[model samples]
Structures are given as structure tokens and as C-alpha cells.
Target: MQLEEPQLKPRDYVVVASMLFGLFFGAGNLIFPLHLGQIAGANWLPATLGFLVTAVVLPLLSVLAISATHAEGVYDIGRPLGKWFALTFMVLIHATIGPLFGTPRTATVAFTTGIAPMLPKQWSSAGLLVFSALFFLAAFLLSYKERKITSAIGKVLNPTFLLLLAVVFFVGFLHPFGAPSSAPVTAHYQQAGLLNGFLQGYNTMDALAGLAFGVTVVTAVRGLGLKRDRTVSAVTAKAGVLATAAIGLVYVLLILLGAMSTNYFTASAEGGTAFNQIITYYFGAAGHALLATMLTVTCLTTAVGLVAAFAQDFHKHFPKVSYTAWLAMMSFASFLTANFGLETIIQWSTPMLMFLYPLAMVLIGLSTTSAWFHRAPVVYGFVVAFTVVPALMDMVAAFPAVISKSAVGLAVTHLRDYLPFATVGLGWLVPALIGLALGLTVYAVQQRQHAGAQEME
Candidate 1:
């Protein structure tokens, strides 16, 4: 039987954007930016802007690139670099954002805001474990199928999530705040306000979700009857722009609210704990509870999406497992990890992302420029080689301070002579640039050889 297709028009981009925003804006979207502003204090304005560039702009562009390229997923998007490279990139991204890190984070955040405060001092940790278990069980149930009912529920709840956040921000702002706190004594970093804020924003992992989101956006566009590749690409780009704009606006508001909170509250608490205090101080305990409920609901939707996305990807790669089986496996894994709590989950995720993100960025760059090299394997090989080594070095360096610090200083010092940009956190940049140069040189050589052979023929 032939199923009817959606003939999506330009106007549907709004709906697409709304859906994308709902998918992208999860737990970190709520509190992390707030903490950034509080940390930046009077420097909040510049810091927030810096955060938006990486946190907001990069993810949106990634979505647009996915659509324009007509890739199956992020791995497909990186196919210009060869199939195996794409597969490795996919594994790393999924591990970071899937069962290992981002999935569990949802339950952790939900528990911190929704259940932790209500617990007595001694039983706090136990309460958190119980809440996360229950939360994932609910998410697992919600994601038991890839059906209309679940999608409809998510669409409905997405708006409520936004509304609750808006309420919290407005209420917090209306109450007068005191002067901003001074910077931490140990705070020594570049773009101090901006760079640190940018890295912190990475916790959102929206860029990782760009791959999952591209699939949904493409499906939605096709459902609207825009099945033509070019049209789908254009529509996805438009929708992504709309979604990013909404996210940037919300981030700005949250950061401002966080900065303002410092006037009335101390900066001593963890961002998560301080967040609850800020809301409760403004609108009372009832408001805090309401916002916490909203956060849990939002995380629930995100968890559902992540589960389904991972299942879809895994089923595609390993059809023998079946989608149902894959979903169950991922859900169980996420459920178990959620017990570790949000703080630990986030702490562990950082080094993984630091190592993997450079590789991901290399793929994104190559994919975006695939047209220039005619999707040649030579370019892919050079770029992958250039990126992988530095990334591995980064992972190795991110370990026990005493051992890695002493060992890495000497290793990096010696390695710097041969490795380009070894000093920058972006050690891959110089190598990637060299790869681009070599790729162009090799392409030129190949083109000349072809011309000579043609003349002989």
C-alpha cells in the first residue's frame, strides 16, 4: 500500500522550527546559561553573546548542513571522508550523547530539581537514586513505540515547557536583585567570560542532537509533500534558523536572570542548587515546584527522543537486533547510569566530548566542503588522520593530574615541534589546514595526470 506523503510548503518551516526547538532545548538549555551569567556577573552581556555564537549558532548551522547535504544522519553527512570514518564519528557522538552521558543527564537533572529538595538531609542521595529510576521508567514507557500518540504528547508538552521557563525568568527578573559578585579567585581563562561560557554551553550538546534532528526535520518536510531534495534542504535550513533564533532569545533571558540573581543570592551553591533558590526566592516555593515539574517534563520528552533516535540508528546499522530490542537495550542502559547523579555524569562527559568534538568538527568541516574536493577519499583520509591524533592526545591528557600533567607537559613539548597548533585546545586546526592544502595539491596532481592520459588516448 502506498502511504500519502506530506507536501510541505514554506509556511510549514515555522512548525518545523518549533519542533526542532522542542527537540534541542532540554535540561542544560534551562540552567547552564543562567549559571554562566551569574559567573560572568557584570561581564554577563559579553559572555552571553559569546556563548550564543558556539551554543546557538553552531548547532543551527549543523542542522542546515545536514538538510542541505541530504545525509541520512551525521555519519552519512561525513561519508565524504569515507564510510569507516563516518562510522567512528557516529559511535563517538552517540556514546557521548546517548546512553553514556546525555541520556542519564536528563534523569539526573529531573531528580535534582523535582525530588532532591523535598528529601531530608541524610536520605537525599537515596531519594535521588529512586527518582532517577522512576523517571527513566516513565521515559522508557513513553518511548516504547515510535507512534503518533507519543509525538503528539511531546508537541503538546513542548509549549508548556517553554511557558514555564518564561514564567520563571519573568518572575525572577521582577524582583529586585543586588550587585554582581566578584570573579572566583581561581578563575584564569581566556575569553574568560566568553570562552568559558562557550565551553559550559557545550554541556547542552545541541550540536550532537543536530544529527537526530536532521532526520526528524527531513521526515517532517517530506510529510508536507516537499520530497524533492532541493526543496527539503531549503526548508530545513529555514526551520533551523527559526529554531536557533528562539533558542538564542531564551538563552539571553536566562543568562540575564542568572546575572541578576547574584545581586540577591550567593554564588557558593552549585548552578543546579542555585537555580532552585533563585526561582523560589522570586515566586516562592510553589513557583520552584512548578518549574521543577516543567523541567522533568521537558527532560522526559528529550529522553523519549534520544531513545527513539538511538534505536533508529542502531537498527539501521544492525538490523538483526530489531528496533524494539535496540530501544529496550538503550533505555535500560540509560536507566542504570542515571543513578550516578547529574554532577558525576556531567563531569565525566566533558573529557569525552573534548576528545570527540574535535573529530566531529573535522567531519563537519569536510562534509561542508565535500563539493570542493568532489568527495574524494584522499581528502577524507588526510583530514581524518590529522584530526584523530590530536584528539587522542587530548583524551590521554585528560586524566589524573599528577601522572598525566607531568607526562603530558614533556610529551606535548616534544610533540609540539612536529604537531601543528599543539598549544591551542584546537590542536587539530593547523593539521586540518595542512590537510586541506595537501588535498588541494593532490587533487591538482590527479587532474593533471588525467589530462595527460586523455591526450595520449
Candidate 2:
């Protein structure tokens, strides 16, 4: 079947970039990284750079990968595995970004930043549950008309949030309370700060979300009446570059603010405490209250959008279910998770990212390489096999307690001794290379066979 192609427009780099940046720079994207910087102190710059590479660069590649390949969507990008593989990939994307991580995180962090301190100590969890439900219901209402609301939010609310954040960070930097110190909370944490910070950026998970957003963006552009293939790809690329640049700038600014916060704040404050303290130190109680309101609104809006998008996607997969039913299920899950508190949520989420990030990276790598290999399965097989091992090691290392309790943990410990570079979370690098070599060798032999057959014919 022949398909009508999508057309493009004279790219508006600023608008596209602004949209991309707005999409990526959710609440955690702004606050947590800064906290990481404050704690890392002198180590903040390196750690921040590493964080940006993963948080910023990987996400950009994800968008670029989709634009360059022109896959129908993320599923098409994983097509060598066939339909079910694509479905599973889709499910993972939804699960990762929905109730499992993203949705709950927005609620939890919002409460921490906006609601917790104001609540009587005992009423906090109950308050969070009630508040999150109301917040998500509002999200549902907004989601009913997502495009208009999202576009409006992008144009108005997003810029205001950014402005407020910029003011907070800039002011904090100008009058930092404590000097930047090399001393971190611990030696191991300090040594691993950059890597940890890099991985933490995964919580933004725009890379995974990009797999879906790319298709959405393409569709939006098409609706604008651009219907050519090259235009679609070009527009996608332009939009991606614009978005990533904004995200990178915000991350760098926040990290600097984090480092500078050390000049006023101390080690006892980390995570949310550092965040609140920095704002209060610079802006006084009124400033803190205003910023808190902005944060609550920002985080709540993000939560609603995430939940609505996920619920719509979920309903598509399970057509028997009503959107309302699914939204309720997701909202309930998010509500329960919010009670776990922000710090606990952050701790638990680490291993999942370690496990998922490498797989996501491989998908991005292969999708981008599809043209070079003519969409070969051989390359995919090798990369997946090689990368899975190291990613598993990294996941276990990040959560030793998880391994210590299960039979799987025992198996991993035994394997670690024989695995080269296993202690360093790089056990998979060698295996991946070997797999690539084997695949290339096989491809060469197959090509020769085809050449001989063609010559004979």
C-alpha cells in the first residue's frame, strides 16, 4: 500500500526548542539535580556534566533516533522483534512512565515541596492522598482537552515556572550561604556522585517517553498540513534540537545554583531540605511560599498530564476498559505510592532505572543504526545480549539489599566473581563487543553467499 507522506513547515527553532524543553524540564528535572549539586559541592561540576549527558544528551538522541528512522512510532523502531515485542516495549514505556514511576513521583514530590511542611505532622500522608486524588481529577478534566490545555500550558504556565526558577537559582547564586566544599556526605557517595547523578537524570525518562512523543509530534506537525516525508523528519530534528538545547541550559543553570547553594547551606540538608533552605535563605518566608505555590502547580500539572497521557495509552491497549476506569486505577496506584514519601520513592526507583536504562539505550542505538545495517536483526541480537549483562550488574549494585534477599541475588553474586569488570558495573561491555563481532562476521558470510548465488543466476 502506498502512503501519503507528511509535509513540513519553515522550522521555528525557538518555538520547537521551547516546546521540547518545556516537555522535558518537569518538576524533578529542576529541583532534584540542584540538590545533587549542593551535596556534591566541588564535585558538582563533573557530576552535573555527567548528569546532563544522560539526562540531556540521551533524550535528544532518542528524539533524533525516531526522526532519522521515520518509524511509525516507537513500536516500529523495535520491529525486528515482531508485533508482540513492540507491544511489550510499549507496555514497558507506559508502565515506566505511568503508575510505576512518573505519576507517583509527581504527586509525592509535589506534596513534599508544597503540602508537607504546612500540614500538622500527623495529617501529612492522609493529606497527600486526598490532595493527589483531587489533583489528578483536575488532570483528567484537563486531559479531556489535552491538546489545547497542554499547548496553553506550554505557552503561558511553563515560561512563568521557568522564570520563577531562574530567579530563585540566580538569586541563590549571587548570595550563596556556605562556600562550596569538597567534603561530601561520604567517600563512596562522593566518588560515585557523577554516575549516580547521571542515572538520576533517568527519572526524567524523556528518552523513553520520546519513543512515544516523537510520533505525537509528527502527527501534530502533519495536522498543520505538512505532508512530505523529508519535511516531517527535518521538522522533527529541528524540534528535537530546540528542545534539548533548552533542557541542557536549564540543567546547567540548576546545577550551578546547586553548587552555589553550598555557600549558604550545609551537608545536613540534602534533597528537599536543601531545596527549601536555599529558597528561604534567599527570598525569605514570602518568597518560599510563592515558590512553593509555583512548584505545587508545576508538579501537579505535570502529574495530570502524565497520568492522562498514560491512561489514554492504556485504554488503547486494553480496549475493553473505559478510560475512566483506567484513570481511576492509575490514580489510586499513584495515591498509594505517594504515601511512601519522596526519599523512599527515590531510593526504590534506582534499580529499575539501572535495569531499564541500558535496554532503552540499546533500543536507541539500534534504531539509529537501522539504515546502516538495513534494519538487520543480527545487530539487535548481539547488542541486546551484550548490554543486558552489564545492565543487570549495575542494577544489582545499585540495590544490594534487593539481591541479598532473593535466589536471583545469590546467582548474581556467584557470577560477579568470574565476570571481568563486574565489580565496576561494566560486565556487559566486553560481551556486547563480542556479540557485535559475531553478528558482523555472520552478516559478511551471508552477504558473500548471496553474491555468489546472484553471480551464478
Candidate 3:
């Protein structure tokens, strides 16, 4: 005789949806779509739609996969693949989404959007060094203190940033820079706008965040009083839809804002520059500090959270290293990486994202369909194994031009060219499908074999 937990109402899911969106929206969410619009230009419609598929659709599915699998954190998300493979997957995910790329990206974005506009060209390098140094240092200090500042980032700074951004969106859209239809479409965009947009969604990094933020969202839902597993999964899926819907809308608006800017300004290095230019246009010289402060504070808060999460997760795994030590290393690495400038950082990040996304996508797909296959390890193993070769080739094919044209890269490129969809940076697709077919075949065979053995017993 147990009392049932009270069911949540629609209003309660709105709060959960907002929480999920807060986790999804960050520096990348702000800039990537703007850059996509600027480059895609007249083709922004298909591009935006494609971006929504990866950015919104995949992430929403990922959140649901988390509940479907009853997993905690990204580590558990990969556990079905086997201990060693799971550990490897977890390491790759956290590294990409943490110290190696995502954390440094936070500082670089803040610098490019906020600080660079206010500084002279010669001072740009020096400015980034100083800013990222102090930025990560402060982050390290705060993370050392049990992440209390997240409260500030959440309760205070996040809302403030959103409010300020909303004002920018309101005014910028109101005036209108130019029509997206009339904007000039770049050559690459003209050729492959949809695929380019899909790739561009990788910049949001939300797919990976979807995996990382899974447990957090689930815990939040549980805290909201949904205790049954089925109920929790339903609530999570509904909440995910609401959250991703909001994100998709924001992405569209950001793209529009960027497309409009083409009327007054030429393309910049990345979306950050465009963002700074747009703010300056609307608010004049005074907008400089306003935009800079806003981006830095928002990005800083994001940086602190990433570093804390990274340090905390790594510390739990390898207790030989102290939390403070892990925190210091990640902060320092991210600061050093930021000095390379935003353009280079983004360029470098693309290759890794190209490789990891397909693998993560496969995992999420498997997790969602776990019940059909009875969570078979052979199925998980075969799919990942088959997908690895093509994924690696796609990654190598996307290396920096210097490396990409080098002998090793060229060899990999030749191999990748043989794979379908290779041209659009998704050469892994056919291979992944083939892998799925093989895994299912093996899973079905195993099920029949076990059934026969049971009859004999």
C-alpha cells in the first residue's frame, strides 16, 4: 500500500522546458546561426530547416533517449557498449564538450563578440591573452568553491543576458538590415545549403550537450514529482519538445538578424564579429561596452560551469588527481587555446565535431530503440565498430587545409570519397546504416539461437 506521486500539470512542464532551454542555449547557440545566415544568405530558409533537424530534432531525441534508457550522465549513456568502449566514448565526449574545445570556445566567443570590437587590431592577440587568462582564472577560483556562482548565472545573469539579447533582437529586427531573400548567397552555400546548414548545426554542440545534460534534466523532472519511469519519460519528451521549440525559434531570429546585417556590413570572420557590428550599428559607440559586458558575463558564467563540470567529472573517475588540480589544468588549457583567435578555434573544432557527431548519433539512436533489440551488446558493438572507419576518415578529411592536403590527409580523403554523402561532410551515413543493418541481423540471430537453446534445456 503506497501513495502515488502527484501528476504534474502543463504549467510545471513549462518550467522544466525553460530549464532545459537554459542548459541548451549558450555562446554557440547565439553566434552559429548568425554566421549560417550570413553565409547561406538567400538560401537561409533550407539552411535554417536543416539546422533545426540536427540542432533541435537530435537534441530533443537525446533527452528522450536518456529517460528511455534510465541512464545517469553520459557515462551511463555509453555503458551498454561495454566498459572500455563506454569509457572511451565518455572521454571523447567530455573532451570535445569540455576543456579541449567547448570551454575555450566560451572565452573566444566572449572575446570576439565583446572585447575585440573595442580593441585595436594590433592589440587583438594581447587582448585575448589577458582576457581569457583572467576569465578562466576567475572561473577556476569560483569552480573551486563548489559552483555557487551557477546560481548567479542562472537566477540573475541568464535572465539579464536574455533580456539584453531580447532588446537587441527587438531593435535590430525592427529596423531590418536587409531581406534574406535579396541577400547574396555565397558559392558553397549555393551548392549545398542544406548539408552546410546541417554541418553548421554542429557548432551549437547541443547534441553532445543533450547527452551530458540528460541526467540533469531527468533529476529536475524527478524533483518536479514525477516518480514513475513511464511517466517520467513522457514528461521528459514533452518538456524536450517545448524546450527545443523555443531554441529553434531563437535560432531563426538570430539568423534573420545576421541576414539583415548584410545591408550595412560585409561578412566578418565569424558570427561573433557580426554580432558586435550589429550592436554597434544600433546603439553606436556606447553599445560597445554594453554588448561586450553582456557577452563576457554570460560567456564567463558558461565557462565556469563547463570547467566545474569537467573537473568534477574527471575527479570522480580518477581520484588520484585532486579536483583543484583538474580544474587548474582545464582552465589553463582553455585559456591557452583561446589565444589562437576565434576563427582558428572554430575551424579546428569542425573536424572533431564531424567525427564525433555520427558516433554519438548512432548511440542515441540505439538507446532510443533499446527495447526492440533487448539491449544486446553485440548490436551495439557491431554498429560502432562498423561506423568507426568511415567516421575516422571523415574526421581526417576535414583537417586544416595544411594537414588536409598533406599526404596522410589526401590518402584518407581518397578513401572517404568512396563513401556516399562524403561530399557534404556526412560520409559516415551510409556506413552507419549498414552497421545498423548488420547489428540487427546479429541481434536477431542471437535471439533465435537462445530460444532454441532454451527449448533443448
For candidate 3, give the lDDT of residue 417.
Answer: 92
> Which candidate order results from sorting by lDDT in descending order?
3, 1, 2
Top lDDT model: 3
The superposed Cα distance between candidate 2 and the true structure at residue 57, in angstroms, equals 0.6
Candidate 3's TM-score reads 0.90
Which is the better candidate, 2 or 3, if ranked by lDDT? Answer: 3
**Residue 297 error, candidate 1, Å:** 1.9
Clashing pairs in 3: none
Query: Which residue pairs show collisions in model 1?
Result: 6-223, 6-224, 6-225, 7-224, 7-225, 8-224, 8-225, 178-263
Candidate-wise lDDT, in order: 0.72, 0.69, 0.80
| lDDT tens readout by residue for model 3, 51-158 | 998998888878878878877567777888777777788788878877778888888888878888778999988888999899998878766765344344445556
- CA displacement after TM-score superposition, residue 315 of candidate 3 (Å): 3.2
Error of 3 at 295 (Å): 1.8
What global local distance difference test value does model 1 have?
A: 0.72
Candidate 3 segments exceeding 4 Å error? 1-16, 141-150, 215-238, 320-325
Cα lDDT tens digits for candidate 1, 1-457: 5545466555456666766777777787877887776777777766787789668977886786686677757778767766776777777777778899998888888778766787787887788777777877776677675553234333566777887877776666666475444433125232466656766666788877787656556665665666567777877888888889999999988777777777767663456766787767776868567867878877877777777777777788779999888888888899888887777787678768767776666666666667787777787777777777777776556544553468664585456436654544556678777877887788889989999999999
Worst 10 residues of 3 by lDDT: 146-155
For model 2, residues 1-457, the per-residue Cα lDDT tens digits are 6555544334444545555565566668767677777666777766777788778888888888878787645676677767787788777776766677777777777777766777798998788778777776666665554344435445665677777877876676676555455334435346887666765677777777777566556655554556777777777788788778777877877776677666655653445666776677777767667656767666755665566556555666677997767767877787777677777877777776767777787788778777777767777777777787777766776674756447877667667647776664556657767777887777778889999999999
Q: For candidate 2, which ten residues in a row score worst on lDDT?
A: 6-15
